[model samples]
Target chain A: MPLVDIQLIEGVFTEAQKKGMIEKVTDAMVEIEGEAMRGVTWVRVQEFRSGAWGIGGKGLTTEDVRALTS
Target chain B: MPLVDIQLIEGVFTEAQKKGMIEKVTDAMVEIEGEAMRGVTWVRVQEFRSGAWGIGGKGLTTEDVRALTS
Candidate 1:
């Protein structure tokens, strides 16, 4: 069973976006691991507070993510 | 760097429980992968909506989880 967890800054995505991510991730895992594992694939989307995510001694906020995505 | 994600039914665990799980899971990964990986290990505890978790043709809800843990 492949469990996929995606972490993102809170308030950035809609429910629809999260659902899409889950479906796509599950499809990718099934494509790699085989169809037998499809039913057991679990995908979760977690949101962290703004400024709670750090990378290379820098904390990232929704503004940082928005700048990149926008 | 290893990312460990734990999935559980919602409402069954307290914040402390989830934090404990994160710490223990991180420690487990570090124990197997080596000490250098400890700093980069990302552990997340995800809670699914009740009745959202499925296993072997059965859907598990918070009630079922509570029953088991109780």
Candidate 2:
């Protein structure tokens, strides 16, 4: 089973967006692994509090993520 | 930076237990990599909904996890 865990800044995604992400991530894993893995694939979305998630020595906030993604 | 994600059955761990897990997992990553990596280490503990997480063709519930761990 391939378990995918995605971490992002809190409040960046709505529930619908997260659901889409889970489906797409699982699909990607199934495409690479095999169709049999589809039933066993698990995707978890975790939102980190501001200042808790850091990249390149800088903490990421929702605004930072928005700017980077948008 | 190493990101460690732990997946488990929901309701299996208390807040304190999860906190301890986060600390230990981060420490393990740091030990394997180096001391400098500790600052950027991210440990996310995810609890999957019952009947959603499967292993070896069987779904895992809190009771199953408790039995296995105990």
For all candidates, state DockQ relative to the true structure.
0.12, 0.09
Indicate the residue-level lDDT of B10 in model 1: 88
Q: Which stretches of candidate 2 lie over 4 Å from their true place?
A: A1-6, A9-70
Best lDDT among the predictions, by candidate number? 1
Q: Residue by residue across A1-70, what tens digits does model 1's lDDT show?
A: 6667677887777666666776777777778888898788776666788889899978898889888888
Query: How accurate locally, in lDDT, is each candidate?
Result: 0.76, 0.75
As a TM-score, model 1 comes out at 0.56
Q: How would you encode candidate 2's per-residue C-alpha lDDT over A16-39 as one tens digit per residue?
A: 999999999998898999998899
* Model 1, span B1-70: residue lDDT tens: 5788787888999999999999888888888999998999998876776644544223466889899999
User: CA shift at B35, candidate 1, in angstroms?
Assistant: 26
TM-score of chain A of each: 0.87, 0.85
The true-versus-predicted C-alpha distance at residue A8 of model 1, in Å, is 1.2
TM-score for each candidate, following the candidate numbering: 0.56, 0.53
lDDT of each residue in B5-59, candidate 2, tens digit only: 6777777877667667777777777778888887777776656787778889888
